[model samples]
Target: VEPKITLTDKELQAEISELCKYAALLDDSQLEVQVKDGVAVLNGRVASSYQKSYADLLAYRAGAKEVDSRGINVHWRHTNPLLRAQRYEKVTDEDIQAAIQRAFKHDPRLLSFEPQVKVEHGVVTLTGDVGHLTAQQAAEQDALHTIGVQRVKNNLRVRWPDEPASDEQIADYTRAAMTRDPYVERHNLNIECENAHVSLYGVVDTQFEKYHAEWIASRQKGVVHVNDYLAVRTKWKPKSDAAIEADLKDKLAYAFVDPDNQVTAKVENGVAILQGTVDTWYMWQTALDQAIAAGAREPHCLIEVRYGLPSGPHYYGPHDYVPR
Candidate 1:
């Protein structure tokens, strides 16, 4: 085996600075980076707390032992350099319904089953039979993320196969699957099963891990329902509501070519609430993701997606679906 080559502090700093310069969410012109003894110090004015945390992640990825970001200040008064041009167009219930139908037809998981999708005033109702619990949830998410969808009513039933495994077998399978999942750490994780109902009790490091654990259980052989009691225990100190809100705003601003004043965010008792109108489903999802990155718990999204008349060529075709 070749000898391991460790990057020096100078090399790490240079690499991190280059990474920042190319980072779409960061304004490297405003940043000053220094590294000494494997510790990276960042001094800059960024628009959001999410951006600051992103820098920390980059430093760690570039072999830095620690990162000090106290010198970074949040500046939200400026517009985002990458903001997309605002569009004023109309989206009807018919458009929403049609989009969902196309999505269902294109989805590899939904290909065999034709889930009935109805849209009334932007609210989508899904009714059909899916082969698995994950398929049902995936259908709901597809509708929820679609443009012009205000709400999703998932009435789809999971039609489990006739051959069923025992509860003990299911529990064992779920545990084994979770252990194989790179994102899920089995430490303190408890999996219980009763008549096909799976309950997860554990402490996870992030919200994604908790959700992933539930998903892993739901895909097991005999699982009919998943009761996730997993709690997220963040490693970092909790931030105030004001800080989280500021971070969310900055993150949204960075996502667009212009500061999207139409979007507004607030945090109430650690729950981030996003209320806004965006021209596309992408922007709407970006707002919610930013809220999560800002350290909010179960961020509520009330954003509206208004499909605009295409200024350029736009397609509604689907890409290859990867279930994982």
Candidate 2:
């Protein structure tokens, strides 16, 4: 027998509130829901392209028997993606670094190798220069599982000194190593060699490249040491302002591929300037990449990520903050 008493308006509102609470927990902004005529209608925005999707995730979790989500807006940034990306590298180098540091401090066998981690906008870039691939991968996996990291960019490559090579072979090996760098390969950063050592006097926009170069130099067979003077140079190369403008426009597509973040770049004499509004740290990194890839020589990107708004002390300062 069906219950005789129908649920009151107040009861429905309370139930809706409870369900929305779960949505808040999921941090899913995919839909805004409404209950009317004993039916739940959902409307909002989602980033996935799948129409027949699991987006009813929160609705189902919250006990919606019949959910209508046709009104929800679908949004996606990349259409013709670079590849069928199984995943995008998202973990920051910092989160992984802290994880490794704490893990080793707690357990003894981890210190035989040097570990490098860089976190920029929640994405971690791992470059283990210990010359042991096994240890490098292990350290990277440790960082991937660390809290607060959304993705990982495995830039960890095997070093030369540990790869069985002579001192003379080391110089040629170092040059070869420098060329293999994605940033170097993509023509993102510039390199110059003096003696057996190489001076990577270039500006890199992302913190990933900043530390990546360091790791490469630290582990190269012949390199005694790399000069840290090669800061994250975001300066662009250009003779005329018009040339700078041209370069900036050309590079915009590389970094600002995501339509949501509106970013523009301009370069003059190797100094790159970026301006635009972005909602997150990931977008900020993209802007930096754009500046460097646009034929900038040691590009110095002075782009704003969050308008430099000061937050509460407890609030993390993104890249500046190292997790406890």
Candidate 3:
């Protein structure tokens, strides 16, 4: 058994050395290939974002039945070199699902969204509207990353494709972004050019409004970056609301006619005092009107007139009022 295993290791190594040379020939693909038995793994990097997808194609064509591709992709800003790679001995169904789920998670645009993808016999079938054309393509490319995936059938639709758009088509992909999006209008969100960069300065009330405005600016082609400084806040509160309470003492001081009735009228940041009022219905009206007209923001006042009525305290609702 030991001798057989030794021969197997030697065979796997030789296969890898030969495949590595072939992988180097692909366009802009810097992949370092390794093989163990019939399985293969590709390491290193590619320049285009599409390198990962293209590299996987080469692996299968080289007669690899199973693949391990964890280190096949690395971002442009990545500094780490590929340490090592080897073909996985066993490929499970969970491996494919894990790879698919990974594609959705790591890709920034796909994380909070869903796409109808059907994986069967290592072939991925994609259907449904994925917000935009680019996301649909990204999902397909991601499916191709899995070890056993044979092919991808892109049945996905972009809800809108005819309208002229402004996105750079590579950076944020705003044209493809606005199709299934609920906010953007076909012709309303105008993107105009200014010195190679686009600036959006406008007012937006709803979240959809802000999203559409940003999308329109983002869609403008030749745009290196979008500079959006739009206003979204709105005034929904009153300018001033004053709650004032006053005792009968203040009202009595204001109305000079009522010396017996101590009355106080509360106004907006103002005070009305009435004194010497022996109450009648006619006198009450006369006293209230005087306080309102003389001092109040809106000619409105809350009047507390003490008629000096002789009565015992009764609890109508709240706390008892102690007579001073």
Winner of 1 and 3 under TM-score = 1
Clashes of 1: 6
lDDT (tens digit, per residue) of candidate 3 on 178-197: 44465543322212233334
Tens-place lDDT digits, model 2, residues 283-319:
5555555555555553444444453221212223332
Each candidate's number of clashing pairs is: 6, 28, 27
- Candidate 1's error at 135, in angstroms? 1.1
Residue 175 shift from truth in candidate 3, angstroms: 11
Winner on lDDT between 1 and 2 is 1
Worst 10 residues of 2 by lDDT: 315-324
TM-score of every prediction relative to native: 0.45, 0.27, 0.27
Off by over 4 Å in 3: 1-89, 160-324
Weakest 10 consecutive residues, lDDT, candidate 3? 315-324
| Model 2 stretches astray by more than 4 angstroms | 1-239, 257-259, 297-302, 306-324
Q: What lDDT tens digits, residue by residue, belong to model 1 across residues 1-324? A: 332226787887877775564443564235788998888899977888888887786666566778899998876754344431111025568766765665564456676787898888878899988888888887887677455667899999877658887777877788789888888854445565667777765446678898889988888877778978665655444788889888887887777655443677788777777776777544554565566677876566666546521111242322111112
In candidate 1, stretches whose alpha carbon ends up further than 4 angstroms from where it belongs are 1-89, 236-324
RMSD per candidate (Å) reads: 21.4, 20.8, 25.6
